[model samples]
Target: MSQPYLAPAELTAEFCGRLLDALDAPLALDHVCVDFQAVKSLDSSAVALLLEWHRRAQAAQRQLELMHLPSALSQLIKVYGVEEFLQIKA
Candidate 1:
């Protein structure tokens, strides 16, 4: 089981790309838990990160879960109608 814990500092496109690119590693695993407690800002790229993870997870027959989501992140996901897809219940 492999997982990447995201930090607010990692909410950039480059970092997100690197992280998403690694989703194929430890291929046996099928879940990603993103820690958003430190995230002070919500960006489209970050949403794409989670969405991409969820997309990859689904495509790869897996799942994506967010941990300790800030209000902003939660609201953003809800706004984008991805709460259901990403299982954003935190």
Candidate 2:
């Protein structure tokens, strides 16, 4: 398995801003995997986060992977009709 960037338990808009700032640096890996094992709660911001991450990865010609997504987050992705835009592996 690939190394994962552990996601926070709360993936809400309040936390997303900080999270984005933390990840604003250039990505060193061609493939980035974000693990949601610790994410027990989330809102629509989760999808925005994933989309922004995916956008960054794509801009760098890299691949972004999502792992162990919470069921609610998964459903949100679908509800937003952005499932095709993300690479969810779990």
Candidate 3:
């Protein structure tokens, strides 16, 4: 939930450059929800960010749910064979 949605004119480049802005008490939160609907495009950077969050949450014994993931983003994740790792909850 800390990641911001900065929709730049360049759809391909549009992204939330800062991925940990609101993670002050990440360990205290029961869950971390990331809304990816506004992400028109996704790339390796997105995957990396997701993985990082997943790892952190797992290490802290917390949960991370990715909501409204775009079809393209989902496809990318599947293509990368990281669906299991994402553990995308409804």
Rank all candidate structures by their TM-score, best first, as comma-separated numbers.
2, 1, 3
Q: Identify the candidate with maximal lDDT.
A: 2
For model 2, how does the per-residue alpha-carbon lDDT over 1-90 read when each residue is reduced to its tens digit?
Answer: 246789999999888877874444535544777789999778998888888888888887877777788899999998888887786533
Off by over 4 Å in 2: 24-26
Per-residue CA lDDT of candidate 3, range 1-90, in tens?
445333222224244356544332654656666566566556766666667777887887877777777777677777788988888532
lDDT of the structure predicted as candidate 2? 0.78
Of 2 and 3, which scores higher on TM-score?
A: 2
Ranking by lDDT: 2, 1, 3
Model 1 bad stretches (over 4 Å): 1-4, 13-15
What TM-score does model 1 achieve against the real structure? 0.70
How many residue pairs in model 2 have overlapping backbones? 0
Give Cα-based local distance difference scores for all models. Answer: 0.67, 0.78, 0.62
RMSD of each: 2.7, 2.3, 4.3
Per-residue lDDT of candidate 1, residues 1-90 (tens digit): 455555655466656666666556533464666667777655667778887767777777766656777776677788888887777664
